[model samples]
Target: MTALLAAWCLCCSLAFASSYPLIKSKPNDTGSNLLHEGHNNTGMADRCSDRGFNAITLDDKGVMYYFRDQYVWKGYIGPAELINDTWPEVPVPVDAAFRIHHRNKPEVHERMFLFKGNKAWAYYENKLEPGYPKLITDVFPGVPGDLDSALECPAGECKSDSVLFFKGKSVYTYDLSDPSAVKERQWPLVQNCTAAVRWLGKHYCFQDTMFTRFNPVTGEVHPGYPLDTRDYFISCPGRGHGHETRRNATLMSIKNRCSNRSFEAFTSDDSGKTYGFRGGWYFRMDSKRDGWHAWSIGSTWKGLKGTVDAAFNWENKMYFIQGSQVTIFLSDQIYSMVQGYPKPLQDELGMQQVDAAFTCPHSSDLYIIKGNTLSLVDLKNTPRVPGQESSIIHSNVDSAMCNSQGVHIFTGASFHRYKDPNELLQAKELPEARNIAAEFLDCTQ
Candidate 1:
């Protein structure tokens, strides 16, 4: 059985190299070709046929379209599935496609370029632009004639180039600038792969039934990779063979980013629901619901029109903390602000200038954070009285929240947890809670 298993592994590894005709001629002695490089050969052929998505591209409106041989699935960043039951076929079977959204150039709308063999087609507003299906050599000067996959990066995140094109076993980059030059460069170590996508600030290479994440800056595959393809995309074996049915939830929403304003947005979470505010914008994340819904703070919470610096829920009441002002409203009252509210923290708790706040999941104490300091506000204490119990517990807190697990605090990129309110938050539940907070609260407005 051991010998048979070894033979099977070798066969699958060879099949991986042989499956891509474009990469067959390349030498296999490079460090990127080591065993456990991208994906194991086992069950790869079966999984490959299951993934009906052949190509993917993002539209001008930020809608991602996943192309199959016959149908195109489109939707916003999250909850994207097939659209228009009767979709038109591409001029040619596409090996890859990407949209060019000129952010700086407002006059130029988005244009989708579909690539196949040595030719490409440009489309605008879903209509074929005039004089398209141009030769790759003529349109994309310096780019290789054939491409297995391609992805574009927004201007802010891309290091050397805005567009990355993959062919055979190597990668090329197009700066998307004047003179239009393509550089033969490699990072995150590209090897045998079927497709690739740029998500957040990292690169993902997909092959067969597995996927691996690489830190483009480090030129190394990040630890804990070669993940199952199903975790990121719909895994349906034999679904793409022929007469494939429509697949929903084909892509994970985490791949999408919200906005920059959420770098340190005020946030609160309860019963799996998270509410966040940045400036006058507010977004609520109902884990039970679909995508996030963005609303103006004034519209969502009447009489509130400033950045929410801190917030929490206590006794079914929602608290909005902005600077030294603390406003209270009934959790059930989604519209009007509470009467005789909007009191100053200095007058109530003797604490001023709160930054972020949350209630302890296990106790009655309300945790308020300001800069790096944390103050435990005892809810059981009487208000307007000097004996109101509140103490400074810790310093250097970036954010704090109470969930069912314990008291979670964010300092720097680390997340510390304490199951008991009286205990110190010693366990590092999350390595980087700041980033997680961004995603959990839909911080990107």
Candidate 2:
């Protein structure tokens, strides 16, 4: 009876230890007010009221396309365009329920495709043609089975390749070798293959919550590496084959279970050969208060780096968002020896959840797409002296596109043609530009 009582007391102590403090601060404490305000501020609540944007699609040339449901729209931004500038809106080929699977670059023209119900259709654009994108092929060949996911690999110098599609647990490799003759070869029984990417010189497939690097050249599946199935979300930021070297190529996985709320970061040293957990970040929320913390490899949870809700790494720099503020760090240096991250990048962009952020593949500028706006900051554009203000380009945008050509901003449905800063500035006078800016500015409020 005495031992039982002691065990109950210990359990209660642990529960109390993890509980949020009832009274965070005194009533008249100014410091308390600041803390309260910081915690209360959650960017434009409406932007995060729902998932800001569902999917971001980019073409080989780096044209960015995105879809927003609140307004019910789909559009693309050209490489040279700014987000706030006007761009042409492409009507959804079928009905409103359809979504884009992948955009393919075949020969000299680009094509957009969508998956509807259990079928996929390809859109074609011809410089001198009058017809709209025609339904090219019904790639799936089974009883109303859903078209799971798809990706396209641009044709390299000597190898003429095409897009790859996955359905159920199997993958089909399409040959765009001849735009006139597109062929698909099925590799059957690729169990639980939720995601697949053409990486290194092989086709890396993710199945059973694990990664299997398959050699397209040899048609053999290599041994699989185990991954935390709890965190199934993954992102691949590069293209097929030789481009692997130039790609920082990191995969981000987040576990959203109420009890197991944590995020994991994984990177490839040599194209998915080995994946080690960089660390895990967690957020705890109860009725009254919420707090964030992190744990590095082999370290206790008490040794946290910082409190963060979301994080992404680019060009060796890790950018984390906590409430409305943003913080940056040289991940290797910080995780190795530096105890803490350098001071955060000043809150110049105001309170905004990093809806989407990525380093430009062709340049050193860091591009952040939030809500309906885009902000650009150069890593090298910082002030020479420490703690001094640095210049940044803030473009009131609706969408962003980053590719080999450069970063482009979209103002409306149509991509405005601009060569230099002067042309882009003059574009604001165009009718489409004015309407888009008016619509986007209203959303900012």
Candidate 3:
């Protein structure tokens, strides 16, 4: 009886420890009193209203806005004046959002993308454009939906039209320069990142009441952050704040149950060798080998460290993808990385990090798979312009390899094949080719 009571007490303490304090100000605390509750009374809005806001983003005009439930509160730069009570007719609850400065040569305009679940709405001056709230896959192509946070990241080689979206530990960058290419970066795992914003050139990520400032260029957290958010934005109490307290509590409880998540950061090469890596730690493995051989990524792999998110083989050469950077390796050696090699993938093939890739043995045509779409890369052709082709493969591909037998694709635990009839007919004629095909299947399966 005593042990049971003690366990109960400890569990209660842990629950209490995870709870964030409600840091709302009184009714007449600050800002203009033009606040009004949204008319849309969905269950999601109730929970979001109780939590105050899910995210806060800054516009190109330097105006900051807080998004909660279906309502939006626009504020100015200094003194934090409320531009409008419930500004912008936000149709639904927002999961993650970012503002974009769409510029195509002579024409330039401000655009906002609001994401909710798998759908996203493109807004211009608070008005939804024609055929909006489309599937995020349709708009962003390779980016996965249901993002936790997003920000307009305009730094480094990324064009002014690029935006970064976060889902768990992975960061997906989509540039308007070429909508087909989607860059990815594996970041340290963070939980419940409620909001993110850029102020004074540095990015600040928020998890409930705490905030962390990150350097956009270095991708490192700046010193003096994870501080109380009250130090930055003033909390103001308004309508719909009190009515959804219970609903907020329920959502928080649900989050506690479903929020425990773990993801892998690894890649594989064409030779059936899987490499497990995270940050600086790395390990290489082969089915023929006994076990994983752990090694220091920086020392062993040289320029190709744990930053590699995807890898593939084409014409005896290996391609490594890290964000927009691509590193090449010759089939013969693994000691030193090729110099002047970590160039942008966009420059070569006009596509970003691919999900899966395989080269056709007969034609030497490289198939680059990103999301559910596929692009054929004919290396023989100069001045590559990526053209899309119809494919039966789905998104979230695991790996792909091609040999004398056929093209094998893996998505999760399932395996698929796209056999070229011409190659099969030709292979039957040559005895050596048949043996090679059998060996290739043995290595892959």
Best-performing candidate as measured by TM-score: 1
Candidate 1 lDDT over 1-445, as tens digits, reads: 0000000000111112111100000111111111121232343132234464456565443344555554453421112223323224344346777766456554433677778788877776666767776887787777876687776655544554366777767776676664266677665356554666553234656665566665443346754567554433432332211112111111111111232323234344344456555444444544211223334465446566666766777666677777788887665413346788898878766677765677754356776666544457677687732233343445665556677666666554345566654554333233333454344533322
Q: Which of candidates 1 and 2 reaches a greater lDDT?
A: 1
Task: Indicate the TM-score of model 3.
Answer: 0.39
lDDT of each: 0.49, 0.31, 0.49
Candidate 2 has a TM-score of: 0.28
| TM-score per candidate, chains pooled | 0.44, 0.28, 0.39
lDDT of 2: 0.31
lDDT of 2 at 378: 61
Locate the minimum summed-lDDT window of 10 residues in model 3.
Answer: 1-10
Candidate 2: where are CA atoms >4 Å away?
1-57, 61-112, 118-133, 138-146, 154-159, 179-213, 217-219, 226-445
Between candidates 2 and 3, which one is better according to lDDT?
3
Per-residue lDDT for 1-445 in model 3, tens only?
Answer: 0000000000111121122211111211111111232222333332222253567764433345666655554441112222223234344567877766455622324566678888887665456767876998997799897888887765332444666777877777788778787878875633346777643233667776666666443456644455555433432233212234314543332212111111123344544455433333343433211111123345344455544455556555666667777887764323345678988888877786676665654354767777766677777678665776545435576555565556555543344454652342233232221221122212121
Q: On TM-score, who's better, 2 or 3? A: 3
